[model samples]
Target: MIVMNDSQYHQLVDDAFERIEQTMDSDDFDIECDINGGVLTLEFENRSKMVINKQEPLHQLWLATKFGGYHFEWHEAEQQWICNRSGNEFWSLLVESITKQSGEELSF
Candidate 1:
């Protein structure tokens, strides 16, 4: 994993989620999001939810859904979050999780 200072890590995660939020806002997706204490909760119309949280100590981002939990590290070369185990893009994994849980296709 590329080493990032805490501020840079936080800023990148914040920016990524803000982009996701903007996508939901502009496209009218059924997902509602709330971020508190560095954790983002995304609630779907069907009532299922996905949560993304920051892990400052490890410099990782964690994603939790009904299926399981995922740990993502900054991939500097790719300029995106990549799952530590599966190597999936954060956006694609998140979309898959939301779709599977909510039965709604999400572009983000």
Candidate 2:
């Protein structure tokens, strides 16, 4: 596991959130994104929601979807957030979860 200082971890996670927000902004999906208190919430048209938040103490990112919850840790070598349990990449799993919930395909 790679060890990141507090500032570095925050910056990396914040950047990921910003990227997600930007992607949502440019897409035509009916998902609404709101970030507050370092938590990103995505509300879909069907009233389902997905949440992504940073786990500062663990230096990990957490995501909750209609299906289940996932914990992701930053993989410094791959430069991606990878689920600790499933070993799925964060963005890919996120897009998959969104598609499953919203019935629309999205890439981020």
Candidate 3:
């Protein structure tokens, strides 16, 4: 696990959210992206929702999808968020979840 201060973690997450939003904006998918109170929410055409939020105390990112909930911690070496239990990378999981819910393939 990488040790990151709260400011660093928040900066990383905010940058991530910006990248995600930009990607989504460039795509023509029926997905709505919204960020409020530091939480990112994606609402699909089928009415399914995925939430990505920061866990400040734990220094982890939490994602809630229709499939399940996953927690990811930053891995400095890989420069990616990785699930501690499943060992899945955050971008891969996010793409999979969005495809599953929206039936549209998206790259993030």
Misplaced by over 4 Å in model 2 are none
Ranking by lDDT: 2, 3, 1
- With a 3 Å backbone cut-off (N, CA, C), the pairs that clash in candidate 2 are none
Q: What is the lDDT of residue 47 in candidate 3?
A: 87
Give a tens-digit lDDT track for model 1, residues 4-99.
898999899889879877887888687798888889998999888899999989989899999999999998999989999999999999888888
Best by lDDT: 2
- Candidate 2 TM-score over all chains jointly: 0.97
Ranking by TM-score: 2, 3, 1
What's the TM-score of each model vs. the native?
A: 0.93, 0.97, 0.96
Estimate the lDDT of model 1: 0.88
- Whichever of 1 and 2 has more TM-score, that candidate is 2
Candidate 1 vs candidate 2: which has greater lDDT? 2
Error of 1 at 24 (Å): 1.8
Better of 1 and 3 by TM-score: 3
Model 3: per-residue Cα lDDT over 1-108, one tens digit each: 789899999998998889889988898988899999779999988888999998989989899998899999999999999998899999999999899888989897
